[model samples]
Target: MTFLNRQIHFTAAPKRKVLVGFILFLFLSFVIIFVEPFDTDQYHSDHKILVLSGFGILIFFVFVIYSSFENLWYLKFRKVWLVSHEIASTILFFVVAGSVLYLYNGLMINQGSYSITSHLLYLKNIVLLMIPVFAPVMLYLRQQFGERIVPLPINSVLLTGENKNEVLSLEKGNLLFIKAFENYVEIHFLDEQDQVVSRTFRQTLSNVYQQIPFLEKCHRSYLVNMTTAKEIIGNSQSAKISFIHGEKTIPLSKTYYKQIKNRLVQK
Candidate 1:
């Protein structure tokens, strides 16, 4: 009985990948931010505390944003899109973090505690710090989670009515059958409580088939999910399909009776 009023489904990246990726990102950020390298720039060598705090905050923000956009990374061109997005996000994070550091460091310099340096050197150091954060993460996302990405249709189906603007992403798998009701269709499926639920959608049988091709055309008014079909009742001229857990039957046109039987055998 859940109501999802959205344009499309957003299946997330695998949970394991998100957990592992977050841990790796967190560890790397801590080391790069807090661990002072031997070749630290003179201008930055004294502001270790400020720099560490700034990068830490930025790293947390990046982790949240990356996880939220994980669905985008599951598309066919995932590696390219994900890496490009990470690179762009990293640059943006650097700019925001740099502005904060600039204000803090400028105040320290004015108070004569830290020495001044060329702005170009400061920007170069920020880029150097950002490289380790972005490069390896992109490579890891592409390599680790690429093959585990779920198929596009398994997660959801896009239902578009006669009006192209009227579109919805319906959950997949549980769909049992669709019945045409005049200009609209009734989508029947099992809900989480194991109860049969039917929803009215402003779409015809043909429109439904275009989005859900797996459904078998049993009659002019009905499309049944062959996987859920239990038995065929009566003869070829007047047969009806019976579904699991229910006695209600769907009329099967003689034209589609043989095709449905053949499809059942293939399954």
Candidate 2:
């Protein structure tokens, strides 16, 4: 069960992408921050810092939502990106909420019509406005992530380094293909039961490649079990080998044609 927590990649996830959005939000919050109500440079005051913080939080969300919607290339390698990205977003929203409140207070002051009695009162107003956005943001992030690591996947194949009891109860058998998942082999049978059962095999792919002399290296990532191989099929341009063990076709490259032909002839 503990092994289930292990990820295919070794690197720790990058800080969330939300931070970049947050920075952008902060830069744009100036429009409201410098408006007549809370113009910091116009009138020097220590309270201006509070106004900046408030505005920064509110604008964070807008930037995050925009950026997260785009195609970010950095997301492919680092898993931790969402953390920093989201934190930045969350901060931006609150900053916006705070900025709105403080700006309102300053506007009220200019009008001499209404004003918050204390600094605490202004702070309270800002915080009260920001809390409501949390639930929806979290829900949106979850839906966007969909519990899957990558939002858009290109080539998805399961590799295995070992062989014991490979089970993917959740996915279908037709989609099941073997590949090296780190030091272990995950017989990624997607359509099995509900749970993916992985076992500990005691050999590396390289070792297995050597010991199983009959099997041919179809690809750098794949080694076919020749004992279970039935026939080599396909045209010269795109070739694939049919396997008897899994009744599946392991792809063959043009360069490996000579070796594959030799093996089949020997058999």
Candidate 3:
């Protein structure tokens, strides 16, 4: 995939993000409780419970926030690093924010930055409302990274004819039907609502099949995205493969029938 200008894909999930955020929030909360910030006033103890409770409340939305950024960055610029940076930056921001809260209550409050009651109220608002501001910052970081230049492949090969070696990449998806760009193929994605997202890769189908052993010659002219294929139908002259990536049917040739059919069916 590195040889071609194919987009790097990571199967990062929102649910995984929720777990990560919940873990971070919980860990921060634990540190705050055990190493409760140094305070001169007894009233400061209640603030710990308030801050932790606030984290718990905000965690549900934390999951939503991180996942939205991942999906958006994946579609917009097709870079995994953007999503990772967004996640890391957001988590680090919260860590700093939590530490600042500790400093405010532990030392600054005694130094008269704000009265004890006012600080407690500020803590409550911070817990509930800070995400709106931080989310944008994280998003901006992702956008900035997206603006960085990654050159697209300069040379391309046609996979079906004399230039068959020129195809740099080809992907098959259940949601995407065959798209012919002169001689290039692009696998498209369709969501539950039937929205399409084109995932273009530069590479010849033959070279990819040779390089990625998991791929097979599903047809004379069609190479099934092995990852997206579910089943195969027909035999020899009229063979076709069924793709799970989308419900599209692809034709097959006699030369590829039994081998490709067996490979797909066994899976």
Give the top-scoring candidate (lDDT).
1
Report, for every candidate in turn, its global Cα lDDT versus the true structure: 0.62, 0.48, 0.50
For model 3, give the RMSD to the true fold.
15.9
| Candidate 1 vs 3: which has more TM-score | 1
Candidate 1 lDDT tens digits, 232-263: 88999899888884566889999999999887
List the candidate 2 regions with Cα displacement exceeding 4 Å.
1-178, 186-203
Candidate 1 clash pair list:
none
Residue-wise C-alpha lDDT for candidate 2, range 1-267, written one tens digit per residue = 444334332112223436444543454455446543323457545676565555455546544554454324234433423444444544554555555555554663333434546444665654554355343543354334333344223333322234455422221222333445467543423234433333445456676544333446776656665544667788656888875435457677787877876787787
Superior candidate under TM-score, 1 versus 2: 1
Compared to the true structure, candidate 2 yields what TM-score? 0.27
> How far off is residue 98 in model 3, in Å?
7.2
The true-versus-predicted C-alpha distance at residue 220 of model 1, in Å, is 0.7
Task: Give the TM-score of each candidate.
Answer: 0.42, 0.27, 0.32
Best by TM-score: 1
